[model samples]
Target chain A: MIPAEGFFWSWILPALIFGVSLWATVALYRRFSR
Target chain B: MIRFGSIDIFWTSLFLLLMVGGAFWFYRLARRSESDFFLAGRGLPWWLPASSVFSTHTATDTPMWITGVIYKDGLRGLWYTFFSAWTAIGAFVAARIFRRSLAYTQAEWQSLRFSGLGAELLRGWMAGWQVFMNMFILGWVGIAMGKVGELVFGWPVWVGLIVPSLITAIYTLAAGYWGVVMGDFLQGIVAVFAILLVSLVGVVAAGGPGEITGKLVELGQEWRLDPFAFTGVSDGDFPMLWWLTMLVIAVVGGFGMGTSIDWYVEAQRIQSAKTVRDATYGLWAGGAITLIRNAFWAVSILAFFVMLPDIKDTAVSELGWFRLGFELLPMGLIGVFFGAILAIHLSTISSHLNLGALYFTRDLYQRYLNPEASEQKLVVVGRWTTAVLLIGSFFYGMMMEEITQWLIFALWLMSAGIWLPNILQVVWWRFNAWGYLAAWMANLGVSWLVVWILPGFNLLPELPDHIQFWLLMALGACFFLPATFLTKPEPMDRLVQYYVMTRPLGWWGPVHREAVRRGLIEETKKESGPVTRSMGIRRSWTPEAAQEWTREDWIAILLSPLVYTGLLFGLVQVLLMQMEGFALLGAAVIGTLIIYWVIDPKLKAVSEEFEAGQARFLDEVEARSRWEEA
Candidate 1:
């Protein structure tokens, strides 16, 4: 089994990066649309 | 022969078909207008060009190169490309500068900034040099794809070189910039998926970050983890002085190229954006994508190191990226990864072909051969130029072997001599065409004499990169300064026009005075008193008409690098699986949000104002054209 810590490091960080990126992208788009 | 299974082939074929279908869709949307063909009618939303910019920079060789660097110098080695953060910072400021200039291409920008014979000469020189550089860049990236083919499919060099080049050329020629950008959007998604897939597999294969750290510590290579650790150490893969030099090149060179209208496709992206805020956001988006991409590459390299500790002596070490995919990825997934590589290669190549055709057809043919040519005729010429570039670069890629050694040799050959002139042309008022021309000539001559010519005569040993860098700087200054003083500056009227329109932040004292005198700028009165025309009184030429940069702009511009640096460090900690570093990740998140809060409202306000102003200007232009026709 992959360690919980391993999943946190490998998956969580990238997921955060992607999640934040998507949020930021949407925020930027809406900012312009207004 | 362990050939690919039917599933692998099917997956790859499906992706290719989708990309080709995307090409046809964009082709249908493209009109016969030159602007549509070259720039997608300059009506693209921020994300299109943003993702296109992100995708274009991810050349196929990028993964292989990053993996090789890790094999040689560890994680600290990423400073080579990481310094590009400066370019992103510069982009924040340059977005407005590029849009306000309103020139179709970087070469055409020469006439807008200057006038007379000097402007004409600069335009011609830039057009010629850009065409050559575009072809050269296309060839370099082509060589990388060729390596990818050889590594993955065991195909001969030429097959890898020709096939992708031909495919990309066809779609680019058929749909022009519209197709190229749309294709990039689709390809960027696949590329991201592939990067994450491989990185996740590598981490799991290495028994997670904990086991990987143990292996590294056991090997006495714990220094591999720290970014700033071995900077000045003399006994490492890269010494302190060498690291400093690379830092300077990345930051300074990146910022210089970032701000200047020197690169073709980047400036095209800026012009292609509908509003200045859209252009600025594109850069921000591109930077975010790049940072994420780099983190995944770093993780993969670290995992590769742990898994293959004993395979240190052979060329296989340098090919760790491909080796990891083949060794760790399942059969069906391997096919997806190959499709991703093709996506990477095609996206970059398509942009180059489109932009190269742009420079050749618009700048050379239409400008010189027939200024009265119709837009339809120019589009035809553009297609022919694309074909020539695609064929030419493929043949050039075939002649290359052992690109690693060649890349090193090319670095030594060219050095960073062109950097100073490039930066100064934007910031300084005195830098002119003759000055720029002299700098390039001197850099080339001096570099050849010092690094190659003199070494041939056995008079001087081959110098290090730092030495060559300094020599180029010294010689570049020696030539450009004398040329500036010797040749006449651009006309004052032209300078004032540029200053009023662009409103660049720099030393433009004389131009500011002219603008004030001509009523183009209103001098702010601190007190209601009669002003005396004293030559010595430095009037703070605050042009009321010029859009003043707000505090938000300043924060976003100055704090971007800090925010990214925080995020990079925070990501590194998380990748190492240290729970305590989650606090750092929290700090990074807070910092990014702070930037977003500061810049978002300002960007919206500014974009609205710019669009309104542009609408009025276009209306006036239409009215005048109609009057003349009547």
Candidate 2:
């Protein structure tokens, strides 16, 4: 018996990771430029 | 005096039975021979090594420590540690770059690069240094884990460290790499599941993340990013200067250490790869896994902060937090969570033992004494060394003495002054025989002198030890590089052919064709043998391999990390929360099954590519060595 409402939309939780991912992706892309 | 009732007894019993039994089962699968004992025949797929590396390192103490740091600092601290995962990936680069070099150990690579007694002496000294260093690290690791055991089982210091270390040592000695890997793999699953399960229970026990975040958020804005942000402490924690110095030393000195040199976890994967590529990918996969796995610990710490804000004596202390978690978790999952924690503890201890033993056998005894020892003898020696190191670690844990009050300083000295100089030579071509050997002797001399003398000085402002170490290394490098060049130029023929055969990415000469025409081999290969180019002296290799973003592999590499992050996120977010109770359980099962199904095939293909690349790299190395002789 627990709440399962908004684990999907936990913006704060994902924010840090998402930012790092975006940065890593962009940097890698800019460098690789195939 | 403290006493535990039947319930407490049951918890310890359950943990011991699961991990020790699992370890025994893994040991049963061990094959005879050096490769089997050390590398598991390099046949395990990506998921296993990926999981094991993180799991083995994330021991009983690690979760509690994260919780303690986060409870004190919040999310930023947790996220900061995840960056080490990035450092670990550098090893993946190392594995891909140097994994399949025909040399058996990182030291062996040095030997191949050097000539005559200069090589042999350098090899022995490096081996000795590693053995000396592991003695400290292994003991510290043991003590850290033992502190957790004390909290869990109400065991005393003697029992806590000795018992666990003994069990890990005995099991590892019997099992070898195959046993360690299987144990670690099983341990990883249990550890993550346990942490996740306890975290859920902790969240339920302490409201939820929303409520928890509200408390943490209210702690002033500065607290969010850096714990020391609002402390008004101008110096910061160790100050900006110190932090920058440590970071530079870490990144720069790390280049010299080479793959399978420092981190035991990296070494395990490096040994087990079917080829260099497999090792590289496996390690990168390890990085990915570490990044994802840290989330569980972070979330759990968040839960702890919410549930027990003022974790005074009992909560913040290593054993104290687990006791708090035990109280929070509901009964059935408690057994499972304990199993996970135990898995984490045992796997970490075993990995440490294996690594410590590795330094003792490969670096010290074998390098110095038994160069012609059979594979079987080495394996036996590895096992015995593991046992001896375990005993030493247990005692060291017991008598964990005070180090030079500035731990960061000593660590820097070890890394920069000692390890960095050696690592630097591999990249810097001017790092010739005399210079390379001098780096070691110089570091030893300067460090020993500084420890005994400089600390007592009156005007000695608080300077970082690592920076000093870095300075010492730089000085050593410059001193050795020039002196050697003036003294002797590495017998021209050996140097030229050595350079030509390796096809390394960097070198000092564009004169190879002209030298070839004129029979000037020295000019053909101005600087000889294997070395790194980026951080070392300037040089470029023939047929320069464009390692990063090979157009064909880029898609797979880029897609892999994304897919992995996505899949993990989806499972944790979507399905785990799609429903509750049995539905949540079903979702985890289904998600794991699906993710594994997709990832296993992809990992296989990546491993095959890496293995092929590594084999070729090895062939090139051997050819280069022979060509130098020619």
Candidate 3:
């Protein structure tokens, strides 16, 4: 029964973590391999 | 029991086909070699191993356990699982250390880290214990799967345990670690989406957040929305002191000592990474995924609370998650959900089978029974062992019908008993073979005395959970210290070799000096500080020899996981719609950016080194292939 604000932000935190870590790892992999 | 519709059956069958097809894709990559079967030829990229590690830990029981926690303690109940952040930090630091040791299994580490009869005995004992442990875990997961099957398909519980387990065993036995990892990757994706689907359905079913909140308030359970408040007993009381005691013990034991990964299967997955960089990043990725999984489950379970507030504690504990999925997910999605549950059970069992086989084949068969065994023979043996383990776990699961009862016993007894020894084996320098033997013996003996013998004889009152935990850890220390002192220390040569290779940060002063004297490592100083690299040393001294943490090592290896752990908790809070948790979310984003910035250079360097190594390996394989053709 969380508010709409809760729904919006809940999605944001996990997305932020997932996007950032994935980007970091892929960037490192590409840089090193090249 | 919920009856399966045709749409459910079709979706479940399709999902199962995808898993099997993915397993076959990896099967072709596997060769008839021990390393190929057991460690993916020790050349996995970060994502494969990381995804596998995350997937393997997400057993069928995971959501059930999380639901039980939320049912009993509300949002604050995450502390129980959050403690693993410490282990993740420890893993980040230890990933390179374990990888550098160049041992195939942790059991084989006995020979790499120590020497003589004591080392041999410890190696054998560890092999046996790990085999037994994996089977126990396999059986535990099987029991959970059986329960899920009984609830979902209206089938006998044993039917549930045997069928999916048999399928998992076939792929694992055929392709070893390769199949296990690939299967895990696919299953991990499906399971995540399934959990998300359930959460989405629940949210809509509850008439959105406003209505859900209204329902919660009407039920007089508004406090459940508070992430910081420790509402005790789920019925709503303050458990002030008890909560504090648990926090202290968990931080000290789980964070301070235990490896971030499962000491067996997950450790094996990390070790199989192509480079130390991959190993560390893989764990970080896995940790992030695990957090996301938790958030999804938490969201769904909270919605369940809103929809079914009047349900009793016993009923919720036994079948809360099952009922929620059955009630909410549509016909086709129910099949998907069922497939996802099977996937969860499959991932756990496959890793156990694969890892158990590795321990037996590498640590026992090669080390003792058949030193001359060929790679192909070892691979065959590993496959056979996987089959045996799967069958054994199936029978054990059938016998242990009551999942809830066994789950409690496992948490309070086996987990507590092993916690101390498990940690000491990784971090403490003085914890030798005898000490390990003594700690486990004392833990089991004392656990038996406190839980069974003393209570049975009425010699003393049954100690409370916290008191018993302390007693077991204390008894472990008491026996371990005495045994270590009384027995001879490990040989100096083995200790020095281990210190040089692993470069573990700890009290290894004597061994370090010996290694230096033997010209194993040279002391050199850069402007930054004294840096110890495992290369030929030059006779130069700029400052006193002292171990200092590199920026990358400190931030990426030690602190990133801690930061990520907070990020995960924050995500859970956000999902619960607590706006105050936005600050924590901000901190997580900032922290992740900082760590990524600091660690990128180190990861780059390590990745390049791994690339060169892999190139050389590929060249050799090509040469060998050509020679065989000639």
The number of the candidate with the highest DockQ is 1
Q: Where does the lowest 10-residue lDDT sum fall in candidate 1 chain B?
A: B621-630
1 or 3, greater by TM-score:
1
lDDT of 1 by residue, B319-437 (tens): 77666666666666666677778888999999888888888877778766777677788788888998998887865576656454555454443437777776676767777778877
Could you give candidate 3's per-residue lDDT for residues B1-630 as a string of tens digits? 675778677767767877766674566556558888988877888898878878998998888888888766667666666644543564555566666555777777666666667777877987887887778788888877887777666779888778888888778978788888878877877777677777767667777666666777888877776656754543234454445555555344433223323645656876788887788778767867777677666666777777666557654563666666676655666777787787777888899999988889888888878776787898889988998988888767776656546555645665676677766666667778878777767876788888778989999787766667767778778888899889877778767757765666656778877887898766534355444432332222222232223545555555565576577777766765667568887787888786766665555564454455555534433332223211
- Candidates, ranked, TM-score: 1, 3, 2
Off by over 4 Å in 1: A1-34, B1-3, B231-236, B253-255, B258-262, B312-315, B402-415, B458-461, B524-546, B549-551, B613-630
Where does candidate 3 stray beyond 4 Å?
A: A1-34, B231-261, B313-318, B402-414, B457-459, B526-548, B556-558, B603-630
Task: Write candidate 2's Cα lDDT for B231-333 as tens digits.
Answer: 3323544344544454454333324444223443465566576654456556656665665565555555555555445557635443434654566554444
DockQ value of candidate 3 = 0.05
Clashes of each: 0, 13, 5
Docking quality of model 1: it rates as incorrect
TM-score of chain A of each: 0.71, 0.58, 0.62
Error of 1 at B147 (Å): 2.6
